[model samples]
Target: MKPFKSYVVRTNEENQVTHQVEEVTESFLGEGNTTIAVEYSSINYKDMLGLQTKGGVIRNYPMIPGIDLAGTIISSEDPSLSPGDPVLITGYKLGTEHTGGFSEVARVPSEWVVKLPENLSAKEAMMYGTAGFTAALSIAALEKNGMKVEDQPEILVTGATGGVGSVATQILRKLGYENITATIRKDYQEESAKEFGATKIWNITENESNGRPLNRREYKYVVDTVGGDLTADVLSKVDEYGSVAISGNAGGVKLNTTVLP
Candidate 1:
């Protein structure tokens, strides 16, 4: 009932961006059919961008910046949802084109909300957030393409210390995949990668280019979180009939590759 609080990002006339927690009211919330009393929100890499000067994430000024949130619905215009219903939401333009979940309250399109599963707590759901969901989807896509744990071929995960890659590595281990390799940029990350059940840890140099058009087939499956030339290199290294699921572009955005690879 009282004015709520949120972290808002605004670009000033001087072209500097300021981000801080501030008080807000219902009117400040974005257009949506459902209003939720937010219980938890997780910070992703995208959330960090909104705080930067030229992060290129916010499509508008004075925005709340969280990509995923979980909470209990306080009100809803849609018939399928009602007050006190537990829910979680991600994507559908949240934190990009719309006011996001870094607040005490969030108003979002009803279609963007999903009923929280009975086994998952709101806090637990936020722990998964966008990065974890991305990781899950990446694995699901690989499975849909016929990658199975039973076959037991070596699986590769790029950027293995990152949010998506780390979670993906652990999830793969949990699902009975024993031969998992994680690619890291530094030597110190080998232990961390192993904690995620990576059977082997590779440096970026080992998996990336040495200027070959197509290298020897190495991995049967790859969950690539870094896109760019690395992706092109990964493509060339994939075994025949294998598939790759790419989900991030932190390395770069452009890809130059031949179909032969």
Candidate 2:
């Protein structure tokens, strides 16, 4: 096999983190039953953290940092996968504890691979990478919990301009949802939120709270990508039998709320 270029992140003895693209061989890849010729990879929040020193994302030094990839198989020891097969990978130890998809070539366990849908190209698959996957999962969970588009329920998607929130908003709109409310931190993001199919744009104030255990029942469903006090506040606003799918903690981890809501 020929050498390929990869984005590598390394930490020094002084704990300084640095990253660069360098040529590497197949031997640099982690142990796996399959090798893929990576066509595309997408950046997620976790990928950013993986590039930072002690960011708590990467489990080892001298690592590649991409959580999602779409590509065609080059070779595989597993019979279930074969050369020329299109596939995508997300989650698992890829890009963290294992050599990830930032490389032109990637080796991952066969169990981590999913055949890409016929309608989706490798580039399109990566565009919906891990962030979009998370958003889709959140929406699926809400639907399973009784969310219905026919009811025209008010759905709130926090962090509306972010990858997950933006995808979720667009997905809901495509699913015929008409009452989507998207929250953004800045006024300027309203247009972007609207472009993502949000029927209403909410300007979220950091650490804003009404000091009550529960506020008015505003939304029937929530796809919260930002955690912390924002989640606490949203929790109080969810209607009875409604659902809130929490997928991130970009805001903070602490949630101070009563059990009433």
Candidate 3:
């Protein structure tokens, strides 16, 4: 009913970072037209990077780092929305630049909040989170790029065990994409991928050679999560004018390429 606790990440006197669970007061939150009683938040890969000492995601010291949250508005200054409305929010620098939702409450700009769809709940929204949204964006991008389920011979989803990959696989299946191939490094993720509608699964190694640019027209569509060399490899093996919907840089950020004949 009042102010509450929030987990925060900050830098120490030596400029080394630290993370602690601390009580947050009412005044510290950013200016907002709506106040939300935070209900659920999810651990995204970006959040993991921000939380881990090894992850350099948090650029500013003394920051909160949650990328997604779902809750109900307590009050609203905006006429487009009212009090007691449920909302879902991901992206828009929620946890990066402003106070975020790894807390009992969050006061956020009303524009940052998205009303939950009729069939979806606060809990369901968090379950999908930013990763799922990114997946949707990837598929939507593929569609925009002229890759259609009815036309593509096969669609390859790389990083098949990860959050984006999982969601993409499910959505693709729901969209009736039957010729789906999943590429993963772990043998254990096959069953899970199959559950999501991956008919073919393969374990690819970083060491495996992905011979030559523009290999024998394998995939008409690719949803790539791991970038760097893998992205390079996938690009090379694409069918003429095929599309690769790229979304993450988990493996490596740099992408190098040379055009094929």
Over the stretch 184-254, how does candidate 1's per-residue lDDT look in tens digits?
A: 99889999999989999889865558767688998989999999988888888899999899999988989
Give one digit per residue, the lDDT tens place, for model 2 in 1-261: 999999999988899899999999999888999999999999988899999887999878889888889999999999999899999999999999999989999999999999999999999999999999999999999999999988999999999899999999999999999999999888889999999999997787643677788889999999999999899999999999999999998899898888999
Best-to-worst lDDT order: 2, 1, 3
**TM-score of each predicted structure versus truth:** 0.97, 0.97, 0.92
The pairs that clash in candidate 2 are none
What's the CA error at residue 84 for candidate 1, in Å?
A: 1.0
Model 3, C-alpha of 104: deviation from truth (Å): 1.4
Poorest 10 consecutive residues by lDDT, candidate 2: 202-211
lDDT of 3 by residue, 122-173 (tens): 9988998999999999999989988776774689998888999999989998
Candidate 2 residue 31 C-alpha distance from true site, Å:
0.9
* Candidate with the larger lDDT of 1 and 3: 1
- Model 2 residue runs over 4 Å out of place are none
Best by lDDT: 2
Lowest lDDT block of 10, candidate 3: 205-214
TM match of model 3 to true structure: 0.92
Off by over 4 Å in 3: none
